[model samples]
Target: MIRTDDTRYALRPGVTCLTVPGGAVLLNPPHNEKLAGLTPAQSQALKTLNQGPATASALAAESDSVTTLLDRLAGAGWLEVTVRDGDRDLYTLRPFSTPPARPSTGDGPRTVLSKFTVIHRDPDGLVLEHPTSWCDFRVHDPRLLALAAGADPTELGLPESLSARIAADLRWGGFTADPAAEDLDFTTRSWSAPDLWFHRRSTLGSRTVTWDNFGPTAWAKDEFPQRPAHRPAYPGAPIALTAPDLGALRATDPALTAVLEDRRSCRSFDDARPITLTQLAELLYRSARTRSVETSPDGAELPSRPYPSGGGVHELELYPVVRTVEGLAAGMYHYDSFEHALRLVAPADSIAVQRLLRTTTATLANGAEPQLLLLISARAGRVMWSYKSVAYANILKHVGVLMQTLYLTATAMRLGVVAQGFSDTAAFTAATGADELEECNVGSMILGTPGDRPRTTD
Candidate 1:
């Protein structure tokens, strides 16, 4: 199980290591794994391994602890034993964790591809999709699907190239993925963190779709998909059917109902007529300002805002990138909901701040650049600390609710507001100087004085 002189290796895709001034580090980026820091010798060994796999002796020439370091990386789901040049076998690093080599059988029932993977239809007819990793590959011939659906490839007369590729993927654990793959009895196969990670990512993000779809925005393909007997929960835990039993859904004011129907999305804003500081404060107070603060027996303080959040955690924070807000200099400010004030963070001209603004302006490509932008972020630990199972999905739900609140509040105040489809997450993190793992930009919105009124009546 250890590397020997006869061994050789090839670095798997996305496995990289570098010696930094602070320290040496390796990353398998597909899973966003920021692994433990490496030592000087360990970095050298990785550089050597990148060429191909080498025996322990070859690696130790760089440092005495090279083998130990390699072993540690392997423990972190980075290594797999493979043959190179048909002469020697050594380990390789991969972004994902590898399971045990595979189960050997005593010559009994049969073998089939793991149910965790699927053969499904796409624009290209049929494809092999790894449920755990969202790694998909196209199939040239439609007949290959039968083999992919547990039929023996040999009996199906599948194309030779297709058969070979399928076999390779199977042997590589691409088909029978670890962690979430089920046994013949349909019980989960692995319990390790990596295994569970693959399980959660695939199942929660892409395997199923919701009517509202506050989860991941991708899905696996299935031909003639049947509705499952059970579906993923759209809402969590106790039902909160807590809305008031007001007669029928009706807006009493004819003008307010007209406002609801006439609301328009303003893609362009007027830079000449900047929004007043008082207007900005009123908007925040109505949409996101804290009305009350309460501390749980566990000592976690919860705050109230116009938008409803799961468990009143209020994990979302707003970073306003102001290009032209009256009485406020062009800069980045963090909205302190409790203080009902903007905490000055950085000037608008700084490189990181400029990058975020420019990137967002390009992303919004709606004719004109925004003067007032809001970067909505979520505190991962605060939200996930309480709801481990449904943390991210509900965070997205909270994002939707808060976004609607901003939209409505902006509409009432006669300011333009529109949420971007996406934003540069890395840029936002740097702009805000936040720990990438602890806080992340979930969504973004732009607002300012409108260029011209579209309409306010249905």
Candidate 2:
């Protein structure tokens, strides 16, 4: 059966099937992986499948060719049995568009979201990308995300037009029907894994850094990369900043050189003696406190921090989970750069807060607790708004700067410090009440009294 122009056919999302001379080629663009070429007979079967769904009985009645062709392609998820009303079923190919979230027949079947489906929301809009779709569906419909999070699309009460658009997006973008059937154990990690999943031309998915997707072919897009306008300073943190003085601003060769040499990774910490509040204040004032807040060309207020950033966007924000800071109770506090003070995020000793501290300790010190742990979160909006390809990476580099800054500062003050590369990222977001996609823990570090320190001569 051939589908008309208005009729939606199941074209495999992200995988492109080309009808070539001797055989048909099936290419999975998202992974840059290709299936074995199909012979002319097999290609005809795929072509028929792409055109429209057919039943084994119907195909068998037409000719044994259809059944034989389908039999070859049926293994390994290439085809699925879709049941209709009265329990009638059709043998369908891998991908078929139109209401990709569910079946076309009313009262036929309600579709569910795939566990692998990642929902990302930006100022631009919501983008839903499943593993199958090597690209993103830029959803303009506001109700879509809310709908996606809730029940099946059929029960959402979405307007006819919006519903139709969503169905089209699901069909075209490669979201699966009945996402619950698949064993998504792998996606549990890959779904929120730190990596760029969406790009033009090149394949998407995987936990590899975004840069890995970059290839000569990826650069051949129609439009060149335009540096986006810098995002405004992180909002809602205290506007007032504190500027504590570090006595004697000395930056000479040997003094600076010694401090630099002193910078070392300290795994052991003096848990008995907690860091004084004065030390925390001084550290913030010198290392991360905002020096100047100025308006950018886009009129967005940008902050200048102690460390350098790619676009001066200062996308990094510090959240210190205090285990034992003098005069400060145990809790998670957002370091208000402008105010130069700690803004209470979660009450002291909250379960979420303790879990984060404990988790960080596990990640950084083999379950040993520290006096202070700084969770470095990136305001991705600020970076992605100003830059393209290198946005997430710049945040990572900024984390490096923050790490070095903390390392040297800790050394100068005779405090122990170390940076940890891993964390329960999803848990971090939950504890901090941060949006998983927008604000994330890019890196983490610990600060406390030096457990092992010795005098050194240069």
Candidate 3:
């Protein structure tokens, strides 16, 4: 709600003006909106504003057409508005999406801070942000911050008119709300602010203010290069996994329908005859081995595997924490999907590995640690490099798909398989000595030779 007589305007950051065949086009990055097919005069006016902030009166002599163009651009949220007093600054309104509707004059509704409004330090400075807000406030004056903090004009010893204007602008910007008219519907009531905030930010909609792979855009890669397709094999003696024979399996393996029906989460493992290395190798080969690697147009290596992954970016890696495997000594081993091999990560008696196994055992009433505790870790940057907002959601989805693949494969092999409901990422980081942000456990499962006891759901 900028005053026409006292406000200054400037082009919003990340906006680029490009000359076209007939005119010029104004591009807004990290958003889908753009001002395409602009006239030459409109471009010139934008260039003038690009030089720095200038009042409408200062640009009035250019032409009547330029003034109208400037007004249109300002209304379109392409220009940031700053309310000034004398030569000193007040505050600036930076629009991340479409600008909020203008505030109505005269006595307005009583307003309080919006529940979703969050004040934090960004790359710029301390600022106010609402999860679904169209614009945010950049406080240049401490008085403005005070108003946001719910201080009265008299408490700050400020002029009533100035405070009123700032308050009206804040209310209109969606940072403040009328308590009587606040949304308290069933959905809003059921959701916490952070949960709702995460939901809105992760999924794409007309209200999305951040960038994503909407058009399968690789904007993230343009800024930061994508991480390598495969994490370098861990330094150790690589044990090659035995790739199962499909031709022989056609005659020997159980039917797919029977396998699906027989898939039960078995908590008890046959400790007397623990799972062998060959069996573990075959299971990994059938479920998680990388089939082939393809290159994207942008030269990124996209690997194909037994399970479907978002964008064929198989960022999930498997680590088998062996406690009772027959041939494979009690140790944590990284399953090199690309090489169809296991690389030792930690030795038989590693503290972190033992703690992970002990925790698994404690979850079951009368069960020992499974012969194999396969931890599925995700390389976050792999998916994040090519996508935004949906990176984490996609990773979780990949874990589910991979889990199903493992379950069915294990069932067919007549082995015990159970997907763990939770995993301690901190313990996992301790075991692998990897950055939690870079690589962390998203899912885990237990696999071993099923015990003779009757299968009962735990």
Provide the clashing-pair count of each candidate structure: 3, 7, 0
Off by over 4 Å in 1: 1-256, 363-367, 453-458
Best by TM-score: 3
Model 1: colliding residue pairs? 8-53, 9-52, 9-53
Candidate 2 lDDT by residue in tens digits, 196-217: 2433213422322245433222
Tens digits of lDDT, candidate 3, 1-458: 33454677887776766655445566775543445565666666666676777776665525666677776777777778887765667777787567645767667676777767777777777777667777778877676667666775445555666667677677768788765556755654566667666666677754454454442456677688888888987897788777779789889999889988888888877889988998998899889888899997878999999899888878999999998888878899999988999999988788888888877875443857778899999998888877767778889889999999999999998898888888777778999999889999999899888888777653
Q: What is the C-alpha lDDT of each candidate?
A: 0.60, 0.59, 0.78
TM-score, one value per model = 0.49, 0.50, 0.74
Q: What is the lDDT of candidate 3?
A: 0.78
What's model 1's overall lDDT?
0.60
Candidate 3: residue 160 lDDT (0-100): 67
Ranking of all candidate structures by their lDDT, best first: 3, 1, 2
Model 1 residue 106 CA deviation (Å) reads 22
